[model samples]
Target chain A: MSGRSRSRQSSSVRISDEQITDLVHKLQQLLPEIRNRHSDKVSAAKVLQETCNYIRSLHREVDDLSERLSELLATSDTAQAAIIRSLLTQ
Target chain B: MANSKSAITLLNSTSSRLCFARTSATFASAPPDQLKRQSRRIKMAAYSSMARVAGRRRAWARALLFRLHTRPRHKTLMRRKRRPSTSSDDMVGKLRRLLPGGETMDVCTLLEETANYIHCLSTQVKVMKAISNHHLSKVN
Candidate 1:
């Protein structure tokens, strides 16, 4: 019985490890900067770092573009600008 | 007969006469000529609006496709100059700091959250680009 329980515990450990690797692989694919490189050379930790940096850059971009859009809308036709504003606020 | 001739002329002419006929038709009991013109204008308006909506949908899809194809302009260079600790624990600590609300998570949970965060950021980028393109196209 002890041997059987130990085997079960080890199987659960293996499963979690598999889950970690699977998620890491998904994160690697999502990152454009890392997707093109030698996949074997990148560690899981490296992928995480790249993802952090990429997300930061994307956030900055969203902020900048939103500011630009509002400035453009301020100058354009009010009717169309209002429509776009409603759509964006959603 | 004169009204019918005028109605035919209205149909052949441009939008100004169409508007004229519609306004005039609404105030009084419209003849078949005026009624035809009004119905035609209503149909055209609906059709044009539908086409505009479809065009916007196509433009958004194109924007997303363009995002997938183009690499981001800013490529960040990662520096290991800070800690240089080769331990996996040190790397995990740094990653936790990088991820939002990540300090309390275990390795598995952290990995899962990272994946979700990455997905959300990419979607945000796609949406921002679509909006910007829409406005620029309108202006130009």
Candidate 2:
């Protein structure tokens, strides 16, 4: 009975060591994937930020164009009214 | 016979009058200066529409980034906690108690769990890549 229990204990230690070795190997395999994922996320975020900046610039340009259009329309309307009034008086 | 001829003449005169009225109406509605201004207004409208579309795409990209940022982080790998050293037997005993199985079974379960974690990470990365592509296409 003493010999049998001693053999079982040693077997258990071997099994545990094998399990630990397998876990370490799996972890090592995952390291590259983790690093790649981190880099991808960083690059994606940078692109997204640049897109936002470009959109903001486009919005500003649209606003400026609309303002200028409004000013041009108002001046044209006044000039047309003046021309019609002068023709009427003549 | 005279009444029919007069009716035909009246019809011809009215057609000519209608044509003149149409031309005069067009001229009054769109003079040279007004036509130029109208074209400019149309061009501005097109640009504004393009800007609105760009703004919408930006919002979508921003939301995607927000979701990615809010995802549950890998806490175990991200933050390593220091622990006091223990004997190999004690550590194995603790693992056995936590795992509630023999060595082979414990190893299988741990491998399965790590595989699932990696799978989840891969899916998240795919989603981020897709979002990035979408943003790039919209920008172009």
The backbone clash count of each candidate, in order, is 0, 0
Most accurate candidate by DockQ: 1
lDDT of 1 by residue, A1-90 (tens): 221133434556544667777888888998998897776788987887787778668756655554554444444543453434544444
Model 1 vs. true fold: TM: 0.49
Best by TM-score: 1
Give lDDT tens digits, candidate 2, residues B1-140: 85344333332332233223223332333555554444344233333222232222232222223333453533311112535547533433333222212233344343433333333333323322332233334334
Scored against the true structure, residue A54 in model 2 reaches a CA lDDT of: 33
Clashing pairs in 1: none
| Per-model DockQ | 0.16, 0.03
Model 2: how far is B45 from its true place, Å? Answer: 37
B-chain TM-score for every candidate:
0.36, 0.28
Which candidate number would show the highest lDDT if scored against the true structure? 1
Considering only chain A, what is the TM-score of each predicted structure? 0.68, 0.38
Residue lDDT tens for model 2, A4-87: 133434556545656645554544444442333433243422322332233334434434433343333333323333332332
lDDT of each candidate versus the true structure: 0.51, 0.35
lDDT of 1 by residue, B1-140 (tens): 85334322222231222233234445444555554445444333222222232222232222233332352423221112355656755656766655544565667656766675555445444544565576577677
Runs in model 2 lying further than 4 Å from the true structure: A1-15, A33-90, B1-108
Candidate 2 iRMS, in Å? 25.3
- Interface RMSD for candidate number 1? 17.2
